[model samples]
Target: MTPRELIDVADVPGGPPLRLFRRGGDFMIVLERNELMSTRMHGSEVALGTMACDRLAGRPAAHLLIGGYGMGFTLRAVLGRLGADARVTVVELVPGIIAWARGPMAAVTDGCLDDPRVTVEMGDVAATIGRATATFDAILLDVDNGPDGLTRPANNGLYGNQGLADARKALRPGGVLAVWSASSDPAFARQLQRAGFAVETVRVRARENGKGAMHVIWFATKR
Candidate 1:
């Protein structure tokens, strides 16, 4: 197999670093120091993000925080589901990934950045969450592959007991924290429990083509 080429890198506030690269036709974003986001066929990323958005039902002027901006799939999915009163804040660590989404992958995103309801927070999601005064109705985190934190060691904190507890504090009562993972993680689920969240795991197909690896999403609700 041919070696993957490094394209560009960017910095984030809290430490899960950002590095964007291309391998042949595939584009990848390395968070912390490893690949945190990638595009497989054409629409798997959007699909996974959509799975999280699908659970966001209601019309309470929802506020959402998306951790990663990989090709803007999750942002696009959220926009499709949200009403005009809803607001979405996308916190992306990598400037290059945002640039790539506006540049090479613009067609896929379909002007999501320019949408009036969307706000782009170009920093570590943890920083924004820690500082935000308002609580969100939903927090969809797809920044890392799973709870183990392969992209960056610091990301493990988000999946750990304290991190999950912080997330619960960030949300409004009964608000949901939807996390997408490359695989199922029982320990992370336990951590969510310890954080005082009602958690549910959903297994999903990885590829838009309907045939690929199986992925998991942990939907944890704050009560």
Candidate 2:
């Protein structure tokens, strides 16, 4: 068995610090004992971007707001589906996450961050959403384990009623809000409905080979 090697640690404001670990060739970003993300199991993360772009097929110049740049999996997936005219704004709360991308994880990053259509913002995604009004064609969120804010206590607002409402207001008519989760949450689906969105909950496998743990993604469209 290969031993896991610690690469570096990053501090998260209001939450626990994140640790980067490597075992063999695979990398993992762990929050305490809970592994937040891994390079090995990213099929669902890729799907989050691919499926959301599928919904916006007709729009060539769509502006997308992606929350959290976890290992750049979703960002790369989104960039693959979008055209030259399309724009993507990625907002990340933790500065070290970006540093890891450009530093130790550069090989895995594959120059996605340097893409012309992408804009990197170091800030809270909720604040970015609040500042906009019908500005985005889609909003992709993979900020926490799920909607209940396992990463940080403040993240709970992003999944609550007001946060959903704010998200609705931030999107253009018929825009999609894509959220990724490690597991399922039935109540959150209903909450999306109550927030006046047409919600679709999808289950996807963690690995690209279509074998691994199951994950959930909620694609909520503004009504």
Candidate 3:
């Protein structure tokens, strides 16, 4: 097998630099030796969007806020589940990831950024949630690995007490806040429940063919 070639690198706030690699026709973004997201395994990423958007399908206008834009899989999937009147606000912290989306991974993005219902913001996902008040029908969080903050120590706040409260405050009544995790965290689930959400834990397959490792997604609906 041929070795993966490193394409570029970018520094991330409160974390190490992100490394981009290419192998054959696929791409991967990694932190140190740990692979973050890949072009190959995307089933769970798509599920992250579908699970959140499906719950918001019946809502009018369907204002959605996506915390991260990893390869644009979740963003694209959410757009597919939403209607013409729906609006998706994607906040990607890393500017290089956005550049990579339009450059090396343009095919993976598939013009989701160009959609009329989409608005892109380059800033901290946490900051966006902090200021928003009952503004979103669904908030899809696919940043870091989960509540533990594998990518950045600051990411832990997204699953922390004040952070969870902020996320809840940003959601409308009956709105859903979905979080993607590489593994299960019982404590995180409990946090969601304590934050006034009806928690539903879902175990999803990582690969599209249902053959890879299982991942966890928590759907926390505002009460």
Residues 27-94 of candidate 3 have per-residue lDDT tens digits of 99999988999988999999999988878757989999999898999999988988899999999888
lDDT score for candidate 2 against the true structure: 0.95
TM-score, one value per model: 0.84, 0.99, 0.98
- Across 1-223, the per-residue lDDT of candidate 2 in tens digits comes to 9999999999998999999999999999999999999999999999999999999866969999999998999999999999999999999999999999999999999999999999999999999999999999999999999998888899999999899999999999999999999999999999999999999999999998999999999999999
Number of the top candidate by lDDT? 2
| Candidate order by decreasing TM-score | 2, 3, 1
Residue pairs clashing in model 1 are: 17-32
- The stretch of ten residues in a row with the least summed lDDT in candidate 3 is 51-60
| Top TM-score prediction, candidate number | 2
- Candidate 3 residue spans exceeding 4 A from truth: none
Each model's lDDT = 0.76, 0.95, 0.92
Which ten-residue region of model 1 has the weakest summed lDDT? 40-49
Q: Pick the winner on TM-score between candidates 1 and 2.
A: 2
List the candidates ranked by lDDT, beginning with the highest: 2, 3, 1
After superposition, the stretches of candidate 2 with alpha carbons farther than 4 Å from their true spots are none
